[model samples]
Target: MYLDMPIDRATPHVVRESVDAVRRWEPRCEVVRVIPSITESRETIRVQWRLADGVIRETEVPR
Candidate 1:
């Protein structure tokens, strides 16, 4: 699975928490890549996870 999380200093913990939550929900999922957003003025974070079925999922969250 893939997730994009927009984080400010306040939401940093959410990233870790979300990852843990997802793992608990889907033990067969593995985190693949993390792409931090660095645009002009937007706070964006991208996460990619690979499922046991060999499928990829992605999500985006904005702060």
Candidate 2:
């Protein structure tokens, strides 16, 4: 739901908001970073997180 918002650019506010939402909803992992990449037709959010076992995983959400 959070990723569905319309954005003209990848601003700092947008990035910080995304990072906060990820941390709030998923408590099991620590968010390493939330990167917002914008292409011509879509926006992609790449989230890097560190699990409790020290494994780092990444997920890309395109909207």
Candidate 3:
């Protein structure tokens, strides 16, 4: 799966938490990759996650 999220100070932790939470709910689900983006003029973080199930999930963190 793929996940997109806004950039923020807690983005990393939130991503980790989300992955963990998902795993806790679905242990068979695997994480393929994680991508992070930070815009130059925005106080936001974008997080993207690719999953084994050929799905994408996105989250946004605002500062």
lDDT of 3 by residue, 1-63 (tens): 223443464557655766677578866556544445556644443445456666866655654
The per-model lDDT (C-alpha) reads 0.64, 0.77, 0.56
Give me candidate 1's TM-score against the actual structure: 0.51
Candidate 2 worst ten-residue window by lDDT: 1-10
lDDT per residue for candidate 2 within 9-62, as digits (tens), equals 444566787788878998888999888887776777798999889988999887
TM-score for each predicted model, relative to the true structure: 0.51, 0.72, 0.43
RMSD of each: 6.2, 3.2, 7.6
Which order, best to worst by lDDT? 2, 1, 3
Residue pairs clashing in model 1 are 1-49, 2-57, 2-58, 2-59, 3-59, 4-59
| Model 1 C-alpha lDDT per residue in residues 1-63, reported as the tens digit of each score | 123543354246656766777689878889776555656556555778897788888776653
Residue 10 of model 3 has an lDDT of: 51
Segments of candidate 2 deviating more than 4 angstroms: 1-10
| Sliding window of 10 residues with minimal summed lDDT for model 3 | 1-10
